[model samples]
Target: MQRPPLDPQLAITFFYYRDLPQAMRFYEEVLGLTLAIDQGWCKIYRICSGAHVGLVDETRGMNKWAADKPVQLCIRVSDVDGWFAYSQSKGLDGLSRLFENDQLGIRAFVFRDPEGYQIEIQSTTRTGA
Candidate 1:
């Protein structure tokens, strides 16, 4: 089998929402993602390096949000505890206590955006062998 030619520059994960402004505020103000591009109906935010997330207005978007959410955005950070504390202070919704997973080797917690998209902030747990 011949491999297909692939040249990837960047990656973006898009989420469709009915309320664009509310979604924007949650991502911009609460989550602190910087806006890299704004296409009027759709806004692109830089998550890190070459990773981005696009927020699209439902009327202008190709798809709509389903009741069953099939996606969860996970962000690896240096400080899970700091993010958890900041989220609590900001009164974010659907916050989970920081917990460790031995198999995954991470300490993490989850919270929901205004549109009910789950965002997980995690840090790797280092073990001295």
Candidate 2:
């Protein structure tokens, strides 16, 4: 008999933070993401149906927090302009103006979270983006 393919239940992208509470507040109040799982030092917020972002305490997590953040978290949304306006109103750090990339067929904006982690919000301008 043929075996079934590997199937994962959920996907989570983890980011380490020096202050978990501050990060939690940003994710909850600013991003409006619901807490799917709470493991004390590690908090998992649901981005969508199956996608999640885990905020881990650097002191307790496997990886330690660093000053420079080379990684960026990008979320695809239906309304890029609306999100940009909301982000500006919140006075987010390192916020970038909404711009479009014709080659990539996307309208996007970027901003840093409370702990300097860059987050990009974008929407597809054309099909199959």
Candidate 3:
């Protein structure tokens, strides 16, 4: 008999930041993500779409862990302007510039998460991509 392969429903990455609680609060309270797991050492946050974001410690890691930049995480949202306004109100730093990329045909804005990581909120006119 043939068996179904194990499928991964979500994508996760270990994000190393200086402060964990602040990140947790930003993801949980500000972004309205549910706290799936909350231990002293690590935390797992789940957003409305069932995706997760993991926060990890940076102190014990190698010096390279404290790099100037990390990979950006693009989050798809229905309303980019609303979220941009909300992030601005929360004192989150966003890229001073905004533009439309003719190549990708996506409307997006870049903003920094609590740990200074880059995040993009994009939306499409169609119901689904």
Candidate 4:
């Protein structure tokens, strides 16, 4: 089968919340993501080039918050230890000890945001040939 031509642009992962302001504060202050766009009831944050996260107010969104959050946002970084320490200093919830995963080729740790969203900070463990 012939593969379709790839013309990738921007990507946005959205999370629905009960309190938009609180989620905005966490993403802005704690995560240090810049607000790229605002749609009144929804706020979009830039994670990096071509990547963003949109926080939507539950009342205005199609879905509501679930007790069992099925999504885990993973951010690949150059310094996993540094980010782990920083999050530890901030007293972030569910902070896990940094561990290397041979299978995944990464060293990572997990933490929860104020709204119970799980975020994973990781660095590549494999060395280039």
Q: How close is every model to the real structure, measured as TM-score?
A: 0.92, 0.94, 0.78, 0.91
Runs in model 1 with CA error above 4 Å? 1-3, 127-129
lDDT of 4 by residue, 1-129 (tens): 999999888799999998899999999999899999999998999999999999999898888887788899999999888998899899998998889989989999999887889999999988861
lDDT of each: 0.90, 0.94, 0.70, 0.91
TM-score of 3: 0.78
Please give the TM-score that candidate 2 achieves against the real structure.
0.94
Residue pairs that clash (backbone atoms under 3 angstroms), model 4: none
Q: Give the TM-score of candidate 1.
A: 0.92
Candidate number with greatest TM-score:
2
- TM-score sort, best first: 2, 1, 4, 3
Q: If ranked by lDDT, best first, what sequence of candidates would result? A: 2, 4, 1, 3
Residue 121 displacement (Å), model 4: 0.3
lDDT tens string, model 2, 17-117?
99899999999999999999999999999999899999999999999999999999999999898999999999999999899999999999999998889
Best by lDDT: 2
lDDT of 3 at 12: 59
lDDT of 3 by residue, 1-129 (tens): 998997878755557778877888877787787877765566777754557777766764333246566678777887877877777777766564454566677777787777678877777644456
Q: Could you tell me the lDDT of residue 118 within candidate 1?
A: 92
